[model samples]
Target: MNALGALAAFAAASSLFCGATAARHSYAEGDKVKLWANVVGPFSNPSVTYQYYERLPFCQPLDGLVHKPATLGELVDGNRLVLTPYDIAFQQNRERVTLCSKALTRREVQQFQAAIRDDFYFQMVLDDSLPMWGFVGKLEKVAPATPAEKETHRISLFTHMHFDIAYNLDRVIEVNVSTDSSRTVDISEDVTPNTEDGTIRAEFTYSVVWSPTDIPYAQRMEKYRRVQFLPQHLEIHWFSIINSCVTVLLLTGFLATILLRVLRNDFLRFSRDEDAMEDAEESGWKYCHGDVFRFPPNHNLFCALIGTGTQLFFLGIFIFLLSCVGAFAPYSRGSMYTALIVLYALTAGIAGYTAGSYYRQMGGTAWVRNTLLTCVVFCGPFFIAFCINNTIAIAYGSTAAFPFGTICIIAVIWALVTLPLTILGCIIGKNTRTDFKAPCRTTKYPREVPDLPWYRSALPQMLGAGFLPFSAIYIELYYIFASVWGHKIYTIYPILFIVFIILLIVTAFICVAMTYFQLAAEDHRWWWRSFFCGGSTGLFVYAYSIYFYFQRSDMSGLMQSCFFFGYVACVCLGFFIMLGTVGWRASLLFVRHIYKAIKCE
Candidate 1:
C-alpha cells in the first residue's frame, strides 16, 4: 500500500511538471522573445548533427547570456539550444537588421564553400517552441549555351533571413523562415579562397514579419502533424496489421482443432483402455509426463529473465497507452525518452517482485543474487550501450552526448529510488511466494530423449517460431527506424499500440505451438527451448535493422553507425527477454493444463 501510494504521488508530480512546462511557451506582448541556434548537419543524413557554430565562422551573442539549462527530454533528444544574437520583441516586426559583418579568411571561405557543396543545413528555435530549418547555401550548375561550351557550377550564400511569425491574439502560433534569393552573395565572386587574405566581407542579416491568424494555440502544431507520407504509411501499417491478425487466427484455429481432435482422442484412449497404458511402444506427449515437471537448470537466470520481461511488458503497455492518449506531447523534444527513464525507475519494484517470486517458486535459496540480477537484467546492457554511444558522440562533438551532470542525475535516481524500491519488492515477493505446484510429480530417473529429424531440432524450431512475430511488425519497423534515424516525425501511436498487441499475441501463440511440438516429440526439455524460441524474434529484428541501415537509410559515418547498432542491440536484447518470458509463461500454462487433465497417478 505504501509503495502504491508513493508511485501514485510520483506520477502526479510528473504530470504536474509536464503540464507546467507545456504552458511555458505562452508569452505576453512586447516580451523579449529568445532565439536559439540548435544543430547543423548534412542535409542528407539527419542522424549526424553537430553544434550549429562548430565549424561555421558565425558571430556569437555579445551579451554573454548563460545558456538555458536543458531538460531531461532535451538532453535525450540531443537538442542543445544556445541563445542567438537576434533580438526581436514578441508580435513586433523588424526590417533589414544587420546581424554581423566580418571579412572572411581563406580558411573560413573554404569552409563556407565546403558547407554549401555538402548541402549543410541548420536548425533554430523561436521562444523555444517553433523550429525553423534552412540550408547553409545554394549550389547551381550553369547550363552550357553551346554544344562545345563546358558547364560550370556556382555557389551562393543566403545572407538575409526573413522570418514570418504567425500569432493568434497574443500567443505565437506559427513560425516560418524564407531566404531572399535576391539578397544572396555569389561565393565564387565575393569570397575568393585562393587569395592569402580574402578581401570579400560576409554580411548576415535578418527580418521579422508578424501576422495575426485565427488558428488557435492548441492547434498551432497541426502543420507538423500533416505529413505527406502519412497516408502511405497508414496503408502499409493497416495492411500489415490485418495480415498478422489473419495469421494469428489461422494459428489459433489450427491449435484448437488439434487439441479438440488429436489430444481428446489420445486422452480418451489412455483413460478408457488399460491395454494402451500398458503398451511399452506407446510414443507421444503422454510418455514425457514423468520428466516434464523436472526443475530446469540455471533456474536463477530464468527467473530473472522472466521477471525483467514482465516489467518491460507492463512498461511498454503503459507508455503506449499514454502516448495514444496524448499524455506526452509528440512534438515536445525528448518527452518520450524522459517518460521512459522516469517510469522505468519507478517500475523497478515490478521487476524485483517478479524475479524474486519466480526464484522462490523454483526452490532457489539465493534470493539476494536473484533480486540483483533482475535489477540489472535490462539496465546492465543498456548502460554499457549508453556509455559507448555517449563516448562516440563526445568524440564527434555531437549534441547527442549526455553531459556528466545528466549521467550523475540518472545514477542518483537509480541508486536512491530504483534500488530501494526493487529491494522492497523483493522482500515482499519472497514472503508471498507460493509453491510451483506442478500437477505431475517428477520421476526419479530422467527420460532418454530419442533422436528427431533435423527439422525438429532446437535451432529450426526457434527460427520458425520467431518468423511469424517478426513478419507482424516488419512493416511498422520501417516507420520507427525512419523516425529514429531519419528525418521523419512519428506520431502514429494508436497504430503502434495495435501492432504491439499483435506482436505479443503472435509470439505467445507461436511459442505455445512450438512447445507442443517439442513435447509431442517426447522431448521434456521445453523450458529453455521455449525461451530461445520466443527470443529468436529479436534476432530477426536485428537482422532487419542491418538491412534497413544498408538499404533503407542514408545514415553514414562511424559515429552514427556505432550509435545505431549499439542502441539497437540493446533494444533487441530487451525485446528478446520480453518475448522470451511470454513464450515461457504460455508454454508453462499449456504444459500444466495438458498434464493436469491426464491420469497422472
Candidate 2:
C-alpha cells in the first residue's frame, strides 16, 4: 500500500479498536480494597428527599451533619442499612462518570476516604472490600400530634434502604413503624460517588444508624421535656416582663400626678396656700397622693431602650413562628435560617430607630454609641460565629455555598434598607418629641454620683433578678442548643415559643423588682441599671452552656472550641437585648416618677 493510505487505514483501525474496548475502572473486583460509608442523618429520607439533596448545592453541606439510621421494616428487611439497591456506591468527579458500582477496590478506598474525611468528624467506621455480599434494614417513626390529629397521639413512620454487590449495591431494605421495633434507628443515606473526578455521577442504596427508639408522642415529649423548653412558657415570661415594666410605668405615672398636683400645690405651686405647707405633715403624705415613689434613673434613656426591645420582641416572635410553621424543615434546606437572618435585620432597624430617637431626645452626646451598639447587638456575635465555623470548613474542605458574596449582600440589605428606616425613625422621633415631652428634667448638675454600688450594696440581688427568667427556660434552651450544635435531630421551634413566654414574664418581673430596689437604694442611674438587671439572664444561660461543655466528654477538642465561641456569641447577644429592654422600661418609669415628685413637693 502507499504510505499515506497505509497510515489512514491504521488510524481508522486503531480508532475502531479503542471504541470497542471496555472502559477502565480502578474499583473493579479483586483490583483493590473497598471504602465504607453511611448517610449523614439519623434517618434516611424517602427517595425524593435523596433526590432533593442530590440536586441542591447549599444542602450538600448539611449531609455531613447526620448519620444513617434504621427503619421499622427490620422484621422484613433484616439487619441492613442498604436494601434493594443497584450500584449503591456513587462517585462525583471532574471527569468520567460511572452510573453504577457494586464492588470495591483500592481506588474506591482512596475516594471514599477523601469524601468521609471531608464531611465527617469521626474516622471511617469500616474499610474493607465487599465480600460480594448484601444486607437488609428496617425503620419506623410516628409524627407528633395532638388527640384531634391522631387518636393515639403518635405519628407512624416506616423506611428501609439496603444494598448488596455482585458488581454494585444490591439488597432488599424496608422500614415500618407498625412492626415490633422498639429499637429503631432514625438516620442514614447513600451517596453518588465521583470516582472518576472528571464530572461523572452516580448514587446507590443509602444507609443510616440511629438510637432505635420508637415510642408514643407523650413518651417522646417526656424525653424532650427533659431537654426542651416550651416557648409558650417563654411567652409567659415575656408577658411577665412586660407586665413588670407596665406596673413600674403605672407607679411612675401615679406618682407623677400626685407630686405635680398635690405636693407642688402644698409647697412650690405658683398659687399655693402658705398655711398648707405647714399643715402637710409627713404622716399625712399618702403613698397615692404624695410623690413618695421618686427615684428613677435615666428616664429618657431607659424609655428609649425599652421601645427598641419591644420592637425586637415582636420581631423574634414572628421569626420563631415562621420557623415552627416549617420554614426551616430539613427537607427545605437552610430556608429557615435565611428567613431568620432577614428577620433579624428587620428587627434591628426598628431597634435602631427607636433607640436613636430616644437617645437623641435624652440629649445623648454619644450618637455613635447608639448606632454602633445597636449594630453590634444585631450582627457582631453572629459574624464571629460565622468566621469561626468558616475557618473550620476551610480546613475540612467544605464551604457554605453562599460564601462571602452572599454575606456582603446581607450586609447591604441591613445597611440600605434597615439603616435608612432607622435613621428615618430617629428623625421622626426627634421632630415629634415636643408633642409628647419626656418628664425627666436635666438637672444643672448630674445627681450625686455614688461609688460603684455593683458589689458592696446590691450586686447579688441585681444578678439574681437578671437571671430569674433564664432559669425558667433552661430546659427548653438545652434542647434548642443541642438541636443547633449537638447534631441531634429535634423540633425546637415550639420550645422556642415557650422560651419567649418565660422571658416576657421574667423580664417584666425582674425589671420591676430591680427598679424598686435601685430606687429604694437611691441609685438613679436607671439606664444602665435596668440593662444590668435584664441582660443578666443571657449571662446565666451562657453559664449553663459552660456547665454542659465541661461535662460533655464525647465532643472532640475541635468541636468543643468551636462550640464555646458559638455559645458565647449567642449569650452575649441575649445579654445585650435584655439590657436594652430593661433600660428602656426603667427610663420611662423614672421620668414619670420625677414628675410626681416635683408636683407633690
Candidate 3:
C-alpha cells in the first residue's frame, strides 16, 4: 500500500480487530468470567469513583420449591438441593463473596448500604416507576465473607441474581439461585407481589463491611480522621441531640434559680407579702414607670414583628421536621429550598399585614422602615441563597436555579401576592383593637439599668446566650451545610429538621431564662440580652464551619463558593432570626414582670 491507500487499508484492519476483541469480551449468558477492572484514573480526588472488579455468582438451593423433577433435576439438583427451609437454619443456604472495600462511619456505612439497595440486580422486576432506562439488578441474599486482612476488616455478601440469570444455571458453585429470587426476572408467575407499583416502592436493604483504613496515624489523624471520613460532612441530627440536651439543662438551671429566689423572698422573707418584689422595684424594672410601652413600636411594627415572627417559627418548624424525615436528602435537587422560600413569602402576607397594623396601632412611625424590616428580616436570606445559587449556576454554566429572570419573577410575586395581602391585613387590624389590661408597678422615670463588671453586661451575656444554642446543635448544622455547600449527597433532611425545631425551642427557652436572670440582676437592658441568647448559635455555626473547612478534603470546589456574599447572607439570616427570637422573648418578659409588680388602682 502506497501512502494514503496504505494508511486506509491499515485503519480498516485495526478497526476490524478492535471490533472482534470487544465482542469476545462481551459477557455471554453461559460463559464464565472472572472480573472487570479499571487500571486507570477516574480523575484525582474523585467523589464518585469508577471501579471495575471480579463478578462472582452465588445462589440458594431449590429444595423447598415444588419442582418438575426432570432428569436434570434428578441428577445433580438433589445432590446440593437438599437444603431444608423450615428445619434447617438459613446461614448455610446463603453463601458469601468478597467486594473491593468497606465503610467507616455511620454516614459511610449508610451510603455503602444504600449503594447496594438502590443498585439494580438482574431479574429484578423493577417496574414502570422508573424510566425505561432505569437501573435494574437482582441479588437474593447477603452474607459476610472472609476478610483479606483482619486489621483492615473487609467483608462481602453473596448476591444470587447473577447465579440464576447465567444461562448455564444448572451447575451450583457451592450454592444455587433461581429466577424466583431475582427481581429482574420476567417469569410469568408473579409470586412476589409489591403492594405499590414496582416503580413507586423503594427497596432499601443491604449489608457491607465497614472499616477505617486510616486511623490515629499522625498524618491521617491530622487530615481524614479529623472528621473521621463520613459519607456526609456531619449529619446535623446526631449533633442536634447532644446540643438540645445541654441547652435544656442550662435553661432549666436558670429558670430554677430565678423561680427559687422569687419564691424564697415572697413566702419566707416577706412572710406572705404579696408585694415582695414590688416593695423596692421603683429603681429596678419598674424604672420604665411612665408609659412602659413608651415608643409603641411604630404602630405598624407591632403586628409585623409578632405576626411575621410567629409565621416564620411555624414555617421553620415544618421545614426542619421535613428535613428530619429525609425529604431534602442529598440526592434531592436543592431547588426545593428555593421553592419553599418562595411559597413561604407568598403566604406571609397575612402575617405581614397583621404586624404592620399592630405597629400602626401601637403609635409607631417610619412606615417605610417597618415594611422594609419585614421583608429584610423574613425574606432576605432567600435573596442571598438566590445569589449563591446563581454562582453555582455560573459554575455549572447553566441557569437551572434562580436565574436573574426567575429572581425578578419571584420579587414580583412577593410584591404582588404577599405585599398587598400584608397591607390589607394591616388595614384590617387597624379597624379593630383589643384592650390589654395587665397589672404593673408604676414609676416616674426609666430604671437606671444596673452597671457592674464587664462579665455581667448585655454584650457578654449575649455572647453566652449564643453559646448554648450553638453547643446544642453546631455539629448538626455542620452536617447540613456540608451537604449543601460542600456537595455531599444526603438523604436525611426529615430527621435533621426535627433537630432544627429542638434547637429553636431550646434556644427560645434559654433566651427566656437568661433574659429573666439579667432582669433579676437589675439589668433591664432586655433588647441586647434577648438578641444575644437566640442569635449567638449562628456564631457558633460560623466558627465551627471554619474549623471544619480546614479539616475537610476532596471538595468539589466548595471553598470558592463558600466564602462568597451568598454565604454571608446565610450567616446574616441566621443571626437575625436568632436576634428576632431573643427580642421577642425579652419583649414578652418585659411586659410580664412590669405587670406583676404593678399595683392597679
Candidate 4:
C-alpha cells in the first residue's frame, strides 16, 4: 500500500477515536443529592421582602430549612425580626428537602452550575405535571475564585430560586424534585465545562444562608413603588422632583398672569375701543397682522419637523400604554428597543401625512421633494447615529451591537414598509382639501422687527422657554438614563406617561408666553423663535446626558462613551422635534386668535 493511503487510514481512525471520546464525555451518572428550601434575605435596614430559595443544592436540607412559615411573633422580637447575621450559621427551624430529580449525574450538576454562573441567576418553577426552572437576577457574586478563573466563568449562583411573595407558608406552593436514581445528565449543548484533568466529579455543595433585617414592610414596599428599584441617590431624585414642580409652578404663574391680565386687557381695549386698536397697530405686533401667517423660509424643513414630531408623539403614547399594561414584563430582553423600532416604522404614515399637509398649506409646489425630505430629515440623522454606535460596539466586540442580519432586517422594514406607507400618506394629505386660512391678508413687504433688549431677544426667550420644560422632566430623565446604562428596570410606565403630558403642557404654555412677548415687542420674526423655544429643551437634556455619563454612571471605555453619546444625541434630537412642534402649534394658535380679534378691515 502507498504511504498516502496509510496516512489517510490513520487520520480516519484518529477522527473516530476523538468522536467516541466526546460521546462518552457528554453523559455521566452520580449519586442522589437533596434540593433544600429556605428564606434567606431581607438583608438591609430598609429591606422587607425576604428571598425564598426553593432549592439549595449544596447544604444538607436538615441544616437550615424551615418546614413551616415563621409566625409574626416568631419573626419579630420587640422591634426587629429575629436576625440571622451572615457571620453566624443558621441552626434553628431546619428540615430535609425533596428533589425534583431524586439524583442527577455529575455532568448534569455541572451543567446546571454553569448555566447559573453564566446567566447570573436562575429559578425553579412548579408544575403539577412537570416542574421547571424560571426567573433570574443579575447581582454581584458571593464567592471567591482561583486566580486563574475569569470573572465571567465563576459560578456565582448555586441553585438560587424565585417564588411568589406569600404571607403564609401554605400559600407558597412547593414541588418535590424527582427522585430518579438512574437518571443521567448530558452536557448541555450551550454550556461547555472545563474538565480536562478527569476531575469533573460532583464535589461542590450548596447552602441556604439567611441575613435578616429590621426594615418594615411599608418602607421597603415604598422603594419598590418607584420606577427604579436601585438608584444612585434616591434623595436627589426627591429634590429633583421638587425642583421640577417649583419650576412648573413658576411658569404656570407667569402664564396665568399673562392670560388673566395682559392678554385680557389687550382683548378688551382692542374690541371695545377703536382708537386704542388703531394706536396699538402703529408700532407693535398689531401692525404685522396681515403677515403673521405668511409661510416662513425653509417651509419644507418646518413641515418635516412637524410631521416627524407628530409621529414621535403618538409613538411615545403607544409605548407607554403597552408598557403600563405589562406587555413587556414576561419578555423584557431587548423588548423596549424592539418596540421602539417597530412602532416608529408603523407610524411613518403620520409623519408623511402631516408634513405633506403642512407643505401644501404653505403653497409648496415641490410636493415630492417636500414629502421625501420629511422622511429623510429626522430618520437620516438617526440612522447615521445608529451606524456610528453600532460600529463602535462591533469594534469593541460587544454583544450589544446589532448583527448584520438584524441591521438588514431593520433596513428592510424601513425601506419596504415605512417608506411606502409614508408616500401613500403624503399623497392623501396633499389631495385633502384642508384650509390654510389666514385671518388677515399678507402684504408684499415683510414687517419690520423692532430692536429689543438682550433678555427679550430670540436666544434668551428660547433658553427661558426651554428651561421650564426641561425642569419639568429632569427627574424622569435620571431614571431613564439609569435604565439604559445601569441595567435597572423602569417599570413605572404610568408615572412616566404623566410626566410626559406635563412636559408637553409646560412646553406649550411657555412657548405661548414667549411668542406673546416677542409679538408684543413688535417682532414679527417669531416663526423660527417659536419652534426653537421649546426645542432648546433638547440642549438641556443633552447637557444632562453628559453630566450623567460622567457623574452617575461608572461606565468607561471610548466605545461605551461613543455608544452612549450617539444614542443620547438621537434622543435629544427627537425631543427637540417634539417640543418644537408643541411650541409652533401654540404660537400658531395664539397668533391666529390675536390677529383675528383685532379689526383687520
List the candidates ranked by lDDT, beginning with the highest. 1, 4, 2, 3
Number of the top candidate by lDDT? 1
Local distance difference test, per candidate?
Answer: 0.83, 0.44, 0.43, 0.60
Q: What is the lDDT of residue 150 in candidate 2?
A: 37
Higher-scoring candidate on lDDT, 1 or 2: 1
Model 4 per-residue lDDT at 455: 96
Residues 448-561 of candidate 2 have per-residue lDDT tens digits of: 434646552445755776555665666556555555455454555664575565566556555655555454444555556566667777777777777766664234446345
lDDT per residue, candidate 3, 431-477, as tens digits? Answer: 56453443553355665655678877766776776776666666566
Candidate 1: count the clashes.
0
Scored by TM-score, the top model is: 1
How many collisions per candidate?
0, 121, 54, 10
Candidate 1, position 152, lDDT: 72
Per-residue lDDT over 1-601 for candidate 4, one digit per residue giving the tens place of the 0 to 100 score: 4844743443343323222111111111221112222222211111111223322233333345433322221122101112111111122211222223224345545544543433422212211111223322222433437877645322322232212221111111222222122222233333344465533233221123222345432232233335453474555555666676677788789778756588777766656666655555365566667667778899988888899988988888777766665544421233455556767888899998999888889888888788788888888998898788777656644434565656677789889978998998888888894869989998888877767788998778878888888878888898888765653556667667777887888898889888887877777777888999979999999999999988887665566677678878988999999889888998899888888887775
Evaluate model 2: give its lDDT.
Answer: 0.44
Colliding pairs, model 4: 58-205, 58-206, 59-206, 99-177, 100-177, 100-178, 101-178, 102-178, 102-179, 102-180
TM-score of each: 0.93, 0.54, 0.54, 0.65
Q: Mind giving the per-residue lDDT tens digits that candidate 1 earns over 245-351?
A: 88788878988888558788878866866765575577889888889988789999888898889888888876886676565654567777777888888788888
C-alpha RMSD of candidate 3: 21.6
* By TM-score: ranked, best first: 1, 4, 2, 3
